[model samples]
Target: MKNYVAFTGLIGAVGCFLLGPSICHATENGGTVWPLGVQTVLPAILPALGETSLYSYTAYYKADSFKDNRGDSAIPGFKLENFVQAVRIVHTWDVTFDNGVTLSSGVIGSANKIKVDAFGSSDTDSGFQELYLTPLYVGYSPSENLHLQTGFGAFVPLGNYDGSKLANSPTGNASYTQEFDLTWFPHPNWEVSVAPTFTINAKNDNTDYRSGNVFNIDYLLGYRLQSNPKVQLGLVGYYTKQVTDDHFDHGDVEDGNRLRKFAIGPQVFYAFDQTSGVALKWMKETSVRNGPKGDSLWLEFAFPL
Candidate 1:
């Protein structure tokens, strides 16, 4: 339980956008709570009761152009590069509920640096971003092989926002999110997991533009090598879609503003002990629309405190 639960990956604080706030309404590009390509391996597992752990992620994201609704380049010379470092801490309660369910809560903090070059505009910004608070996270292992977890959280806009800059703030305008994950181990060394999240955005008081609802799914299929049980190799990926239309002044704006993307990559994990490990992965994005087509690289580490 300790080994598996230590991989309860959270990408809750990685949603800051590299573009300015006005782009959210002009191009229908907005930040999301569950960023693509950043979820953990065994996301459904939870730390044992009374256990606390820390997870840190370092990520780099780059995109050369923006895509329109037809999947064509809308901004040919647009370029963006972003780097983020996030730390999350989760603590499982000492009590267990009926049906042998355990409970945990967590918080995440992140700092980001973003640079953008496009439309004859170049700018860069770096600062601490938002705070993500997870008040309740529930975990249940029906058997030794199956785990399920769910949680609720919110993003607090802690960073400053200015509508005039080409490179904007790392924090979003604020949002609420719900997350769910399922992990199943078919064999002793085989793992399969899927985690999905939905976010409801708040109106950006700075711009009065409200983004649409966003949904995302992250998945992993991995196997531990018999020759080296400490090493695991797998495939990881994500899919995201905007489920609703954007709004302004409490009115719906149905202007083909939905965003979508899909990405897949390879992952490698090494366990140093029962409760400590590190993972690295790379994701290449395709089938993108109304957003940037990019690639992301991530290095994640987790351990007990």
Candidate 2:
């Protein structure tokens, strides 16, 4: 069991780094709660379950500073403060039929808040609260080393400032998202996965707003150390692109359109057993569209219920 756990963790960590955030089928641990910092890596390990049930929880705190083109601070003395705080709970179950096929499904809910301070004055300057429920569906090891999953989710806007009081009134009236995930373990110690996501807005009342198409991609690649399985490390990257010319309506003039962002970093993980583990990760993003640029740091601890 210890060796299996270590091997699983190593495969998961390496797959996560090579594929970025896209590898979900190989690392799901039924019901477990993860510490705040390491939650970003949670999606990478969802495929490892086999005829088991699990639960997990995760929380995060993030801060970012934005810079504009020519590598200059966009807000100058007023550093546009960007931060995200969120918590999520997940439940997973795996079912194997007599035909040697397995299916897994789960439920996930999250509460998150995003804040942007263009002037570094107060938290009240710009911020919004979001709540969401996601359906988890996965197919595991149809053959020997492959997995696939797909789902649709919605994001509800809980709170936001009025258009007249802000600079970049960037709040989703209501949004729906569709996602697809693919994972492949060509070998026991090497893994890779990819996730591509599309989001559409149900309603957009803000002025200066254009289309509602948003695209996001997550990739991970990881390798186990000495095939020991107890520990592993890998690289992770994420990319986001907006398909339309969208602008925020902040009482004043709106800002932002055709935005693109890419981030790359490292992720490390250690497992105590089949039901417990810890992960630490960091990522930095640069805007290709002269928008805001920043980095994120995270730590996470997870244990199965």
Candidate 3:
């Protein structure tokens, strides 16, 4: 345990440098929590068999995005509508200790392509983006049935960002995110997991715009069908609310602004074998305020090594 503890700090610094400069902000170009499916969260549990384990995963998501309308209700140009597709890959490595605790870290990069339709014509924006970097993670199990995880994810400026857009989180400002995760297995076939997170943002030096701090939660509840590890059915959901006010260098926005949304959906997953697994989920924003109101779907694939 002591040796692994020392190793964690050693590797953490290297991970930070490899991930690139820290203050860049390419926030939610696509959205949060891997599109919400509890059945498929990565590193579902810490491994006990090896010094380290590698998990490579891919997720794709689509969403409808829009901004506040400003004109005639009958005119379609009154509001801008956009459809965004994000393809992301996240690589994470976990190191296990003699005491069974695990330390995980990873980097995520993505390609986002958005199509905007307005006034009977459409324009598009596409670019490769640096999404996020998880510098460290600590996992522990206090009981056979309970698992806990704590980590911080730094939101860097790795994506294509332009401050002129009506609304885009990824193209916004830099932020530091903190996360707390808990999973419980009350019965052999039942499991529940929840992760709550908070984010703090810094002013965008390029545009002097600062998005509000945010609070969010990701949750999942699952039950195995029969007794096989090959298949499981579950429910997943997420809630995101901006707790602080957004500000701009412009004097008009000095008062600040905020946004919030909630969503829920279903999840299904299956393991092809011990080496690979896949899951599918969909979440529809049931309510929204000062934020994009739409639905999102996620297709997740994971490989363990």
Candidate 1 — worst ten consecutive residues by lDDT sum? Answer: 6-15
**Number of the top lDDT candidate:** 1
TM-score of 3: 0.73
* Clashing pairs in model 1, backbone N/Cα/C closer than 3 A: none
- Is candidate 2 or 3 superior in TM-score? 3
Cα TM-score of candidate 2 = 0.67
What C-alpha lDDT do the candidate models reach, one value each? 0.73, 0.43, 0.49
lDDT tens per residue, model 2, 59-96: 23233433333334434333233233444443445565
Residue-level lDDT tens digits of model 3 in 95-126: 54676576666555544544433345444555
Candidate 2 Cα misplacement greater than 4 A, ranges: 1-83, 93-115, 119-122, 125-128, 165-171, 206-211, 247-256
Q: In candidate 3, where is summed lDDT lowest over 10 consecutive residues? A: 5-14
**Range of the 10 consecutive residues with the lowest summed lDDT in candidate 2:** 3-12
Best by TM-score: 1
Q: lDDT, candidate 1, residue 102?
A: 90
Ranking by lDDT: 1, 3, 2
